[model samples]
Target: MNAPDASDDPTPLALPRVPRLRVACAMQSDTGCVRQHNEDAVGCMIPRDDDPLALAGALAVVADGMGGHAAGEVASHIALRSMLHVYYASAGPPPQALAAALVAANDAICERAGADPACKGMGTTCSVVAIVDDRAYVAHVGDSRIYLLRGTAFRQLTQDDSVVARMVRDGLLTEAEARRHPERHVLVRVLGTKEFRPAVAPRGMPLQHGDLLVLCTDGITDQIDDATLASVVRSHAPVDACTKLVELAREAGGADNATVAICSLQAEPLAAQPDPSIRTTRETRAH
Candidate 1:
């Protein structure tokens, strides 16, 4: 697709004037104490010199694919690449850029699936965190999640859109039971399927100094509770924290493909504003 026309906003569209925020990312899809090949993919993109705003705010993403052979991996790469292309080309308001990216990704994935018979039924779960200025913009589908850590307080920022998540929401099942459900991994929506359009939420509120944000697949969340996960995130460095978190899941029986991406925020050198994602993680308990 062609890039969007440039415009003047005065505010840094090409780059955020803040000191560059650096990130450390890693993905170890170990087929998890089982299986022959891994199907999880995770990535992080920092805005280049041409797009300094992205550097000010970073983009971290995780995708979990499901299908026979290596089809899942292909599905995830296409989705992530499509999103990066759209977001960089358009250079619009943060929320608008994120929304457009998601749509473009969905289309690109579906197109790929249609062209390849081996990947006929392939699909993937996608969750992303875009840190721009002091804010974090999040767009997700399926069960992958984004979490925030502030001091000793840690919380999940995105909601799960899977069958089990919905069931838990409707009070049809308890949180504990949902965890043990035979079909807990069943996702209601994902990328690279026929006629799919995920409901896009707005860019999340901005982050405060000393805040930490994480993105990961169900492989990690399934085996650990929020409190334990939070404890680790608040204590370790972003890279080490993820390593320990994944280790915890393995100890609890890592039953599926796993991936994680982390970003920590400190004081910015440029002008800053209030960020919404900084608020505590919201909860919705069913009756």
Candidate 2:
């Protein structure tokens, strides 16, 4: 018999199913009760099922911009948009790509500032979270933060790069003191400042099922304390939690732009896990 003609069959080949790191996310940003322009920008990329980065990870960012007029808005937009572009386009581990993305964001902002005189002194505080399997990689600068709520304990994972924060770190100021300090808003490190030295965090932080990650600007934090924030998240889904947080902030007489993003990790069964990943030794988690 003659070989079957290949053109006889018109059925499309089925694509293999891909296992994914399950995550549910929600975010909200508002100009708040005072600011006329919303300078804060947020972005995230959940890799497509067929894309290689799907297994490598997903990324989220919150940037609080600083400048006069519309400069801050431009800076934040550029930082967020550039980071998303560079992150999904890069290679290597998710942690390494997260670091590279920050650099690209900084460079893009710097170039924009140089091109526009009105945006000369613009800068932004950037905080990012990259989730890969049971690990989370964080890249942060300025005073924005990433908080983790696992079980009954909730704490900040990203340290603020601000004057008061540094003081608190050095023991010159207590946590409460820093929170109420006169210079709490003075940030020492920020993107678009031309002084950024992006530190690459090795590997990723270990995460567990039922873990919730919150990334936000000071607007949300300055209004709501950690305990209250955690309570809202615990009582509601990510979508409702985000809106509730924003409402709470505005209710507290928020005076600046407020932005918040949350991601919840669902249970991962043992059978679905891939081969064990190597944990980093002597690895430092830098913001």
Please provide TM-scores, in order, for all candidate models, with all chains considered together. 0.81, 0.85
Q: Report the C-alpha lDDT of model 1 over 1-287, residue by residue, as the tens digit.
A: 96754654344334323443444454444456654567887877776646756543577778888777988888887777876777767667767777787788878777777888888888888898777766778888888998888888787888887888899999999988998899888888888666676565654685677888878888888877999988887878877887888888888887776677778776744435334324456698999
TM-score of 2: 0.85
**Model 1: residues with Cα > 4 Å off, grouped in runs:** 1-29, 48-56, 269-287
lDDT of each: 0.76, 0.87
lDDT of 1: 0.76
Off by over 4 Å in 2: 1-20, 268-287
lDDT of 2 by residue, 1-287 (tens): 99978778666454443343478788999999999999999987777667877876778899999998999999999989988888878876777787888888999999989999999989999999989877899899989999999888999988899999999889999888888898999999999977688865786888877889999999999989888999998889898999999999999998889999999888655468453442335768989
Worst 10 residues of 2 by lDDT: 12-21
> Which candidate gets the maximum lDDT versus the true structure?
2
